[model samples]
Structure formats: C-alpha cells, structure tokens
Target: MDAETLEIRTIEVTPNAAGDASTLPDLLAQVPADERITRVGGDGAYDTSKCRAAIAARGADAVIPMRRGGQPWTTDAPGVDARNETLRAMKRLGRTIWKEWSGYHRRSLIETKMRCFKLLGERVASRSFDRQITELKVRAAVLNCFSQIATPHTIRVA
Candidate 1:
C-alpha cells in the first residue's frame, strides 16, 4: 500500500506453513513492472536473504531491520552488500537512528491497517476459502474507503 494514501497494492493469501519470507517474492510480483517503488519496509521477521533478494530484485530499498544479535550478510546475494552496509550503520549510528534514516518507521503504517482490520472483526465469517478471500478484500476496500473519507482537510488560519 502507498504510505500516504493507504491504498493497497498487493494481496497474497498463502497457507499457514508458508512464512512471510517465502511469500514475499510472489507478493512483489504483483507490483506492476513499470511502477518505481522506492522502498519496501518490513519488520525484523523479514530480515532474511530471500526477502531481501526479492526486494532487491524489484530495484527497491529494503527498509527491514536486522534482528537482535543478527549477523551481517557474508554472501554475494542481491541485497546482502546493502544489508551489511545497514548493519554497519546500525552499529555506528544506533538502531533507532538507523531506523529513522532508513524510513523503517513507515512499516507501522501497515500495522495500523492491520489494527483497523482487527477492529472490524478478528475472525473471518466465511467458511469457504474463496469466500474468505472475498471477505478480506471487501474489508480492505471498506477500510480504504473509510480512510479516504476520514482524511482531514487542513484549513489554514491566518
């Protein structure tokens, strides 16, 4: 989703056994080839080579943070060198500052969307797989509409 607009761009429904890292490549594929994405942000859970590679393959900066006690990448993978550079920055500038510099904080925008989804309802009412997906899509659409309608109009007071 766009950070400013909160408009969803990709939706992938994977089985429980598949971790987020595994589904990332598929999710990234949903982005239009012509679109120029600047950054892809995720929590520490996505701080793996596969996820990083998927982001780098799309020519976007990975805003994911390394986990505690995380080691710098030693391989020549797509995003490993950049990850190592980020690790060094984290070491020198500290985690908080590095996160700020890297725009990792934007990850919370998705979290806010999740929170709104939960607020609508935690459990899917539909029993069938296709129906459940449809339900989720409908919910996402509603939330997006609500977000648009609720956006404040700034009136400058002299």
Candidate 2:
C-alpha cells in the first residue's frame, strides 16, 4: 500500500485514531484474550518481544522469520531441518517467477492489489480521519462484492 492511502498493519485502525501507531496496543487490548488466532504472517517490524510472547501465550505459531543480528536459538522442531532444502528448491522456483536469471524476489501480487485500489478512483475528497476510514471500509466491501460477481461459475446439464 502507498504511504498516501493505506498502511499494511495487522491491527485495524478506526477513524478516531487513524495513522497513529500509539493507539495500536490499546486497540489490541480490546480484543479478548481467549480468541484463538492461528499463524500470523507479518514482516519483521511486528517482531517486538511483547507481540511474540503474546502470540506464544495464545498457542499460535508466529510464521515470522527471525530478524537479523539476533542470537540463533537451537531447538529441535519437526520440519525445521527442511530450511536448507527449501532454499535449494527456491533457486529453481525463483528463476521461473522472475522470467529471467534468478535472484530472490519479494512477491508483488499484494502490491498489485493495492495499486488496483488506488486506480479505482476511490473518493478521498475528505481528509477528515472519519471520512477516510468510512471510505476505506466501503472500498473494501465493494471490492469483495466485485470479486464475487467476477468469478466464473460452471454448470453442466444432465
């Protein structure tokens, strides 16, 4: 998402406190502790100790990769040994994804979706935080509805 429109965040931002990072933890607190979340995938910025510990407390696996320059912990977990093999396989798969010679590339499909949102000419006429949030929700809802309409259905006559 562009800096102008949306920030990619795991937390939802209400209009009252949009664009404010200070409100995130308080918003997170409002979510019940008992609710079970499975794997959470995010970039390393969400790698704060508190966030990690909280996820562990809830019995959820954090799919987050370890950040650089940290002490590597040694633990014997199943499927953990496959990392080296996966990197080897990535060499082959990564080449085709780039359409030429290979180097690891971040997937751009999510960025493409964000670009589509911007291109849709969604109304951002009001700079007021409430209006921006209201428009964001409407845009998301409309996008989902359009996906439902655009999906093809197949029928077979007996």
Candidate 3:
C-alpha cells in the first residue's frame, strides 16, 4: 500500500495455508524493481527473518515491530543487524516510544484501508484462484479510485 496515495501498489491473494510472514517475500517481489521503496511497515506478525530479509533485499527499512519476548537473531543474515538494532531501540526507548519515534502508527492507515477493503466484500464470489485474484484486484482498483476522489488537495498560503 502506498501511504501518500492510499493506493494498493500490489496485492497477493494467497491460500489459507500460507502464513502472512511466509508470503511476504512473494508480495515484495511483485513490486517493480525500479520503484524506490523506503520503508515496509507491518504488525508484529511480520517480524520474522524472512520478511525482514525480503524488505532489506529491496533496500527498504523495516518498520515491523518485534514480537513480545523476541530474541535477537544469532546468525549473520542480511537483515539481522537492522532487526537487532530495532530490537535494541525497542528495549531502550520502550515499545510505545519506539513506535512513536519510528512512525509505526502510519501502519494503522494501511490497516484501516484493509478494513475498508474487507467491508466491500468479506467473501470473494469467485471459486477459481485466478478469478479470485482478478476479483480482489478489481476491488482494490475501485477502492483506490474512491480514495483518490475523496482526498483533499490543500495549499499553504502565507
């Protein structure tokens, strides 16, 4: 999701068996290579090494909060240093303060957008996987259109 535009930049409809963290890499891969991604934000569920590594691979800062009682990674992995640094910051500043400092609250906007998406239709009418994907994409497009129309354009006058 694009924070500035409130658009669904990419969407992936995975099977129920696939976990959010596990499917994150595939979602990140869908993003065009040329697009510059500065930050990837998500809930604690996305704090896994795989998700962090995927974000790091795209050269984006991970804004995912660590899970409660999470331990630092013992391996020398691509995202280990950043994740550990975030963990240390969380420990030092405290979770609430760290979240405020890191702008984690911006994630709530995405969550609200998702809720609105779900409100459009909780269940997809299509039975086939391909159709389901198309259905979701169409819904997202419609939502994006609505967001674009509703958003106000403001100018500052001195």
TM-score winner: 3
Task: Give the Å error, residue 113, model 3.
Answer: 0.7
Cα lDDT, model 3, residue 96: 99
Prediction RMSDs, each to the true structure: 1.7, 8.4, 1.1
TM-scores of all predicted structures: 0.90, 0.49, 0.96
Candidate 2 global TM-score:
0.49
For residues 46-82, write the lDDT of model 1, one tens digit per residue. Answer: 8988999989989998888889998987788899988
Per-residue lDDT over 1-158 for candidate 2, one digit per residue giving the tens place of the 0 to 100 score: 21222333233446544443344345445557775555433344544455555555555554433344433334444323332333344354552552222221232444555576677674576688777767776776665566557657789999
Worst 10 residues of 2 by lDDT: 98-107
Candidate 3, residues 1-158, lDDT tens digits: the string is 99878899889888999888888898888889999999999999999888988998999999989999989999988889999999999999999999999999998899999999999999999999999999999999999999999999999999
Per-model CA lDDT versus the true structure: 0.86, 0.47, 0.93
